[model samples]
Target: MLEATIPVKHKVGLHARPASLFVQTAAKFSSAIKVKNLSANGNFVDAKSIIMVLTLGVMKDHEIVIQTEGADADAALAALKSLIESNFGES
Candidate 1:
């Protein structure tokens, strides 16, 4: 398994369209992806699960823990980190 901690840089945080983009990105990987909000009191959810993501209520500056496992875990994680670093490329 691979893991990393990512910070939300988007002004509106990970919600709505951003979350949808994330979902799409996650689906590209064959590995299992998961996201956990520690600052939100240890709430964790499957990255592919939009409902779980919305439940976390992620906010700007909040920290999310990303983890994955499978054949493409490394590549998937790098891509995911890049996406997070770019704030989902939304304005």
Candidate 2:
């Protein structure tokens, strides 16, 4: 398993569009991806589920822990981390 701790850089946090993008990225991997909102009292949720992700109510600067386990765990974590670090390609 691979894990990464990252901050939500998007100005509006993981709302509809960003959450959709996140779910899409997570689904591309063979790994089982899970996310925990560290800033939200360590609540863990499925990374591939947009509904679950949205339930996190992640806000800007909130820290999240992403974990993946499977054949492509490293690649999956890299892509997801990049997406967040890029602010979901939004300014």
Best by lDDT: 2
Tens-digit lDDT string for candidate 2 (23-72) = 99999998999998988875779999998999998988999999999999
List candidate 2 stretches off by more than 4 Å: none
Local distance difference test scores for all models: 0.86, 0.91
lDDT of 1 by residue, 53-83 (tens): 8888888898899999999999999998999
Give the 10-residue window scoring lowest on summed lDDT in candidate 1.
37-46
Q: Count clashes in each candidate, considering only residues at least 3 apart in sequence or on different chains.
A: 0, 0
Q: Estimate each model's TM-score.
A: 0.92, 0.95
- The Cα RMSD of model 1 versus the native structure comes to 1.2
Error of 1 at 84 (Å): 1.1
| Model 1 bad stretches (over 4 Å) | none
